[model samples]
Target: MKNASRRQVLQGAIASAIIIGFNPAMRSWVTSASAASEFESLPPLDGILYTDSATRNAAADDFGHLVRRYPSAVLKPGSVEDIVRIVRFARSHKLKVAARGQAHSTYGQPLIEAGIVIDMSSLDTIHTMNAEGAEVDAGVLWSQLLLASLERQLTPPVLTDYIELSVGGTLAVGGIGGRSHRYGVQVDNVLSLQVVTGAGNLETCSRSQNRDLFEAVLAGLGQCGIIVRATVRLIPSAQNSRVFLLFYNDLAALTHDQRWLIAQKRFDYVEGQVVPDASGGWRYMLEAASFYTPPDEPDNSSLLAGLSYTQGTQQIEDKSYFDFANRLAPTVAFLKESGVWFYPHPWLDLFVPATAVDRFVGEIVSDLTLADTGQGPVLLYPVPTDRLRLPLFRVPDEAVVFLFAILRTAPPDASAIAKMLADNRTFFERNRDTGGYRYPIDAVPFSQADWRQHFYPVWGRLVSAKRRYDPDNLLTPSQGIF
Candidate 1:
């Protein structure tokens, strides 16, 4: 029922447009418009389809605040049927299609110049929930989904640090955070998906059914199919959580303690960050969390009695699970209000081998100052390799992989953007030489050759999947892999 050809889906859209009073005179103006007018070739459905300048400009960029790619038209689908119609129409006409969810990408991965941009956010719907899992629309934000699930006394096992991103958006790129070390990436926790392929077929896939699609679509970067809906695994929710913060002046000591802590399974969650040390030196802060009932609060002293931390600098806090998960709300609010949130973010994310992390951090941190990174945090953390099972989400061969990120935000001036990109390039080249794998979500100007190198062993499988599911390369034209 979700699959329909272009001609078969026009009635709903036509009816809606008529009800809203479609402007007949605008047809003449649309025809004379830029190449964006090519959208007129497609049949409509129950959605808002337009090529006006306002909508076009709004869909042109993403969170990076760089790379403007104006799509021919933006389609806000009211139902899955509309997506099927729009994609089928684009495939038939050899036009490109990009499925956009929240536009949180640092690069222009979701933008398609002179092509159709499908706004998936309008399809937001959280259908059902249970102890096992919940079936929800891809456009639903992780924060929104978490709130709804908490109401039912359940929650997703793994959540990114920033939950404002869309489910499909993070799933496509392998969502990672502190919990990932224990539960695995968001993509690994999926149960099933309702994907609309480039060929315009609405296929339901899971681990046991349509197995190839199920594997390919996770972290598939919208190259294989557009994930319209997903069944996410959930866990019993806890009422409260105990949080810990430990500081260290030495990188080796911090990373060593992290490895020991994760191996012993001493905490429910573990991660670390690098901040400017008081005496103009870089310091490491280890963050851990434990869930428990209010009646059975954990002994913070017992938990940290053996760990080595900076003398007399340990901190502990207690918060409800909801408040703990949403602790970053204040930071994000400050960024938004400071006007820096709109600045161009030439971000870089990479996974370095645990063995090489010491040297990697040493080289970068030696020259890195707060000013050099646009005052953004230089986040560094370790993750277990066993949790990441998908071949497409590449990582180092070591037992532990360290995630190092340089999240830089700069003014819109050409010189500022150029300087940030230059710094990013230098950092990336050094990391690549050290056998590190780029996360690909950052603003790296990747070449086809670079992408192949990034996915060497699994490159063939990815290509095969792309051909099988999106033979015409009609999806995610901005990723530049095809």
Candidate 2:
């Protein structure tokens, strides 16, 4: 009894010291104090804490290059225990905390101003793997996990097009990829998650236990808890994949073929995009992949039997499964070398109902010129509605839905940003009229009212969950939902 009482007293004293050191009003005092001394009074852990200008500046912005919110300190937790200690310290001191996993977010969704930013990348450890699934640290990238799984002749069921993204980052935002039609989104493939709640409780939740937290944290937008680790479902890895690129001049024809292919399960992977044509018009490109061994490779005639694509406008290639998944790595390298990779990416991702996809595409693409879209990609693909079951991830009421992504790279000028924002708004309004939902992964400045309207039926559940998990509302303030 005496020892417990002593521990309580010590914890109280430490909490009081942290409150004073982290107080926003005492900014000057903190700056003047020795960086070492300022943090010495807080909890002791194995992680590294950086309060320097350079470290803070690096954590200020994300892929969007729009919002730059300075954090008070950047933390690289050495282990899961270190994360728990840091979150507990922040909870006791009333300091907001946000997790940064590669900072791939195009919006300021992961940025936390005047608070602590927990860098999750330091905890990249793959714990174990088996025939059923793999258990890995949240900071592990999909690419890393894929390689590890491949060694065991297994691979994750769903992977984003860019495998370089962190596992927790993609799961938090409902990771979707070319194979999502067969499996589901990455979140749908998760078996369990280890989360550090706002109250500093390190809890493991799954569908059968702590069900609410599991659902909320899947696409919860980091409002409830920070996912420290996850159990990802895996399947047998294919030896090779055959890729076919089909081109079409008419939008309806392309979509018709996509619908037919997906419904028939004729392809292991399916996706399509719109690009500028040499004749000053837009062209649709349908990409499909079939997994097989060299002996079982499908011929072009059989694969392209009845698609509505122009003859002789097809490119077929046989690539190893690993090579096919990592195909976009070269494109990213070129973008970086060309100096446009770091530009303002006012990207927009939308989910339109299958019934309304035709009208939405025709209207948006017909009104824009090649210059307006810049050199980015106009990604359009179809995904089934029933695959996703998260309430917070709003979707249209249809059997099928289309993911329309306008990944635009804009100049750093204010006027250019304004024009992109206007175009996004125009498309957003059109999507709203057609019963579509904003994917919320890209850059779009939305008000609280707009968010409420976007999440009409689930708004109450979200608020209640936030109250139960993060009662102080101290997590992910940049989302601006609360």
In order of listing, the candidates' clash counts read 0, 0
* Residue pairs whose backbone atoms clash in candidate 1: none
Best by TM-score, which number? 2
Candidate 1, residues 175-229: lDDT per residue as tens digits? 9988888888999999999999988999999989998888888888888999999
Q: Taking the tens digit of each residue's C-alpha lDDT, what string does model 2 give over 1-482?
A: 21124444345334322222343244421422334444324565565556667777899999888889999877777778878888887776678899999898888888999788988888889999999999999899999999999888798988898898888888888999898888878999999999998878899999998989998899888989999999999999888999999999999898889988888889989999998889888999999999887666677677788898998888999898999999999999998999888998888899989899988898888976766667789999888877887777777889888999998888888898889988898888789888988888888878899889888888888888889999888888898999
Give candidate 2's TM-score: 0.93
Q: Which candidate is the best by lDDT?
A: 2
What lDDT score belongs to each candidate, Candidate 1 first? Answer: 0.83, 0.84
Q: For candidate 1, what's the RMSD?
A: 4.6
TM-score of every candidate relative to the true structure: 0.92, 0.93
Clashes of 1: 0
Weakest 10 consecutive residues of candidate 2 by summed lDDT: 15-24
